[model samples]
Target: MNARIAPPATVALQPDAIIRHARAVIATEAEAIGALEPRIGTDFVEACRLILNCHGRVVVTGMGKSGHVARKIAATLASTGTPSFYVHPGEASHGDLGMIMPQDIVLALSYSGETDEVLFILPTLKREGIPLIAITGKPGSSLARQADVHLDGSISCEACPLGLAPTTSTTAALVLGDALAIALLEARGFTSDDFARSHPAGSLGRRLLLRISDVMHTGDDVPRVAPDVGLTTALVEMTRKHLGMTAVVDADDRLLGVFTDGDLRRALDDVGVDLRGATVTELMTRGPKTIGPDKLAAEAAQLMEKHQIHALLVVDADQRVVGALNIHDLLRARVV
Candidate 1:
């Protein structure tokens, strides 16, 4: 008869044990980040200086989990005024190293400072004479020794219960990368407008880059009535344009006043005003709030909120009505 082996016994974790483990992980990671503050000295400063002066892109490379961090760091750098991109260390050996130019600087991540894939490309980096910045746990490791600048991303212990998986170490690396990017961003004097150029598809970019002219209704869509026209004609124009308001203009289309639905109601409630005889200029809100088409759509929204109105008449330098946009237009454009 064949001998049979029994399976190892399993211990189901209690709820308290699970909670305690979670707290331990959080505490360990927090302490690891806390440790980084004191270590942020010349090496971190030099990394920022090198990137700030770099004429070409910052080429980031690493292996495994560090590789993931490398990609994110590259993305952050690229988006925040520093030109950067991630190249897998393994791929670098297989002809991708050509992507690195003599003007570019290489940032290599290897927590242990001895990741083989990263090590494999070190000779190529040296051959090309590209400046190297290394992030590693071991200061004496080959990767750190070869670098022109070394950033210590060491951690006392992993958040993992086994103490083998990268948890605290990865967090430190990621945060260090962020520190570098933000420092460069500040040094470059990167503005919201500059950031918007890199991220035109994002909400913050839209808020910064989207001009009123881009979202406003122009041509025949704009609700306009001559100042001499009666409130009845202005009402018909407002209804036809479906904008709840109409701009009263002169013969030259210069904005005279704005007559909204609210003005119509007040006119009717007046004791002596006749809708058929009263002109738009008499019933309209003169010197009404106006915005230029070149202004940001966000500014338009702010004006609507502050004045308790839904629409704005877009004018030119001469205050001639050229376009109109209500909250509905902003909503349609997702700019509200």
Candidate 2:
């Protein structure tokens, strides 16, 4: 016995041991993804083409843990430009079979490809002439053999010593599903703008859908001055608006130029400039950075960054002043 008493033994470590085991399983599964690059063939491309031509939402189904992975894959597809949803195979045998239509394609996931819950629904799908795609280890299994397309989700071995849990197989299935979604995205020329439409409330959507018009200061809040206004008057308007710059516009509010503190400093540096008496027409910069209200705030930020501008004027298609915004507007809007 040591000077200090030892702590009591407990079962908490048994669960922790499983965590280490899961990490190794995940690493092994990642290796499987790297290996898939070379193994991918014409079948994979053909599968992608089929998915692209699909007129209906993807219907994903599986049993047990495979069902869990299937649900996530369905979600990933739905969010990334392809429309999809998950169905439990057990439920599909019930009234859920009504969810399937001939136009919709079914994606079934199973390690052995012999899951009873999944296999039970196969006959009806077949009789209905619904095209089927399968992900499994054994291509000879009933589900795999019946599918119109078969993707190899096999792994060298399970990370589990008993080789019982669906660890490696599930990860491989997930990776394969991601591969299919990404391939289809590229094949269809799916863009971030399109993806944003599906996720309108997310960060991506905010970046795309929230345009300069959505967050810019318009009407009285925008600092405006006639092209003939003195630099002194323009400076007062800039400070009043607190947007750091003022637009110099014509009688019709068509843009003439822009004036900012930067231009004021440059004017001050000029050998013969008189800030108090000089007209804004003489001090204002010609053709300063401006943007259309239709453009994305993200695009506006990019333009501001490229031009080293602290603020920008938002104009309509006719180039008439419509609004004003600054870099801080992007931050306040949380679109940055």
Root-mean-square deviation of every model: 3.6, 5.2
Candidate 1 steric clashes: 0
Model 1 residue 211 distance off true place after TM-score fit, in angstroms: 0.9
Which is the leading candidate under lDDT?
1
**Model 1 TM-score relative to the real fold:** 0.93
**TM-scores of the models, in the given order?**
0.93, 0.82
Cα TM-score of candidate 2: 0.82
Give the Cα error of residue 293 in candidate 2, in Å.
Answer: 2.5
Clashing pairs in 2: none
For candidate 1, lDDT tens digit of each residue in 73-175? 9999999999999999998889999899999999999999999999998888899888999999999999999999999999999999899899999999999
Error of 2 at 240 (Å): 3.8
Q: Which stretches of candidate 2 lie over 4 Å from their true place?
A: 1-27, 262-278, 316-319
